[model samples]
Target: MTGTPLTTILIVDDEPQIRRFLRPSLAAQGYAVVEAASGEEALARAAEAKPDVIILDLGLPDLDGIEVIRRLREWTEMPIVVLSVRSREADKIAALDAGADDYVEKPFAMGELLARLRAALRHRLRQAGEAPIFRAGALAVDLVRREISLAGEPVKLSPKEYELLRLLVQHAGRVVTQRQLLKEVWGPAHVEDTQYLRVYIGQLRDKLGDDATKPHLIATEPGVGYRLLVELAGDAQR
Candidate 1:
């Protein structure tokens, strides 16, 4: 009988060097690696391989990485993490907005990248199997009851605060952009009014007791958005 299959990760990049660097590193970590040199090939391999997660490079020889993300999102929700030399804030926002799960800038540390991969995988699993009660360490949100609790104690929040927290909880472990949050919470007219977000986020954070300096719950992504960090339900170590 065959043994358990390794979790597969598709590496899509135009540069041969990046692929060469990542393959062995990932394989050593017990991952089955798949490679694609261009956007078209990446799509083809994605369809054929049905890999668990994808690491995509934005500067592709054929299709742009954002477009590739759009196309793949059309068919599969397979987690896409963009590994790009493009460190511009706009590119990061565009990629995240287009459905990429995470972004890793060039000249990245292998340890950080590996941690991101694990986090992305965990995020995908969380999305696939959603629970009514969402837990991230000491934080917990009861989706069905519209309740908020931290460390087994009930937490009270205002309407706006609850909505903001609700949105964060809905997309736990993912970056929700300022534009997206502004639009959803305030409205199109208020999308440009970022002060509302600042005020509300502050209130929400305070109520949640999430420290701004060393945040445990909500993390600010600096000129991008916020990512609600997550942990195992029972504090299970990964």
Candidate 2:
């Protein structure tokens, strides 16, 4: 298969055999693979190289995987997939809270990992604004341009924030469940952290200047998830 022209991935793990196993597979699928053996090295490589995606191992020599993820989140928005032997629900939640986009158990199938990678890339592209823009009241979202404006002034969003908004906008008028949001935003391992969803949604609403008591564009579904109310009359093809 022909590789993605500009796609690159970083693999961070202490095991040389794991790196050796993943290098050729990712390369075969058209991704440029950069390897790091420790958490410190991973941070340095991530800062300098800025890979499009990261496949990280949770157990590292210098630091825990969650710390590495948190440190990376402080500076970058790249998709991070955590690979670990731990399968506990709390462990997964911690990783997601720290900013990992996805998590995979150890001894995972290569095909499944590739499929997850593809899904992540597709979701990223969609959020990056590959469709027509939409407008509602004083709020305008330029999907093609990947920009949001409130009353004509630009609204800045972090990478994760933008992704979350795009998901809402794309599924306007529907009640998106908390599990769905977590799965899409923080990956499959984070479907249970409702608090994270609440916090992020509050932040988004605040940033958009929407009243939490009476939101115009975003709405809460009580015990469920959130929804984006599309007031625009026309079909905004996306």
Extract clashing residue pairs from model 1.
none
The TM-score obtained by model 1 is: 0.92
Scored by lDDT, the top model is: 1
What is candidate 1's lDDT per residue for 1-20, written digit by digit as tens? 11368899999999999999
TM-scores of the models, in the order given: 0.92, 0.58
- Prediction 1 global C-alpha lDDT: 0.85
Q: Show where candidate 2 strays beyond 4 Å.
A: 1-4, 130-237
> What is the C-alpha lDDT profile of model 2 across 39-138, one tens digit per residue?
9999999988889889999999999999999999998878888889978766776786676766678999998688556645544554577557766677
Candidate 1: 10-residue stretch with minimal lDDT: 229-238
Error of 1 at 107 (Å): 1.5
User: Positional deviation of 162 in candidate 2, in angstroms?
Assistant: 19
